[model samples]
Target: NGFKLKEGRFKLDIRKKFFTLRVVRYWNRLPREVVAAPSLEAFKARLDEALGNLV
Candidate 1:
């Protein structure tokens, strides 16, 4: 699943160790799932896994 996250319609808290993504204007594009990591390493790992799947 590919979804583009934009601040114009959502809230994002991006930090070195933690990130938070929230849907503010969930009108047409309601989220089907939510995922977050407590650490940057974990986040990168998750991102890598997702990218690997795509290729």
Candidate 2:
């Protein structure tokens, strides 16, 4: 299961402000290893580690 979401085409700039569009932008930025975690606990750990590296 991939974490990527197909972003929909938007005819207007305002469409980019939609919650789904905003979330997709953020989601697509995550590291593949974080997104590909095999379980919820693993995902949380990976996410925490990844975010910690940003600091």
Candidate 3:
């Protein structure tokens, strides 16, 4: 599975903060295991477990 998403070119700095762009940026930073989770529920569980360690 592809682990990265292509970011769209932006003409203005503000465009980089658009929802789609922001989401893409965040998504790209996720671990490969999290991004490659086999199901939505599994993804959420894995992501939650991963993020919990930061607190």
Candidate 4:
């Protein structure tokens, strides 16, 4: 149902029979960043957007 990244400090929840996934990041820090209602393709798009934003 879910997977986590130790270094990046992010968690992903992929549910069955659902068109959306959830992403939770920065759990160890205050005011954790959580994102939901993201489709698989939209998730990838967000990743690309983040990379571009960092550039």
- On TM-score, the leading prediction is 3
lDDT of each: 0.45, 0.88, 0.86, 0.39
Expressed as tens digits, the lDDT of each residue in 1-55 for candidate 3 is 2688899997899988788888887788788888999999999998998788668
From the highest TM-score down, the ranking of the candidates is 3, 2, 1, 4
- TM per candidate comes to 0.39, 0.69, 0.75, 0.35
Q: After TM-score superposition, what is the CA distance of residue 15 in candidate 1 from its true location, in Å?
A: 24
lDDT of 1 by residue, 1-55 (tens): 2354654432543532233334433322432232355577875776667656669
- State the lDDT of candidate 4 residue by residue for 1-55, as single tens digits: 1343334322443342233222323322212112232576765676566556668
For model 2, the run of ten residues with the poorest summed lDDT? 1-10
After superposition on all C-alphas, the RMSD of every candidate to the true structure, in Å, is 10.0, 2.3, 1.9, 11.3
Model 4 residue 36 CA deviation (Å) reads 2.9
Ranking by lDDT: 2, 3, 1, 4
Q: Write the per-residue lDDT of candidate 2 for residues 1-55, one digit (tens) a residue.
A: 2668999997899998989888887688899999998899999999999889999
Worst 10 residues of 3 by lDDT: 1-10
Output the better candidate (2/4) by TM-score.
2
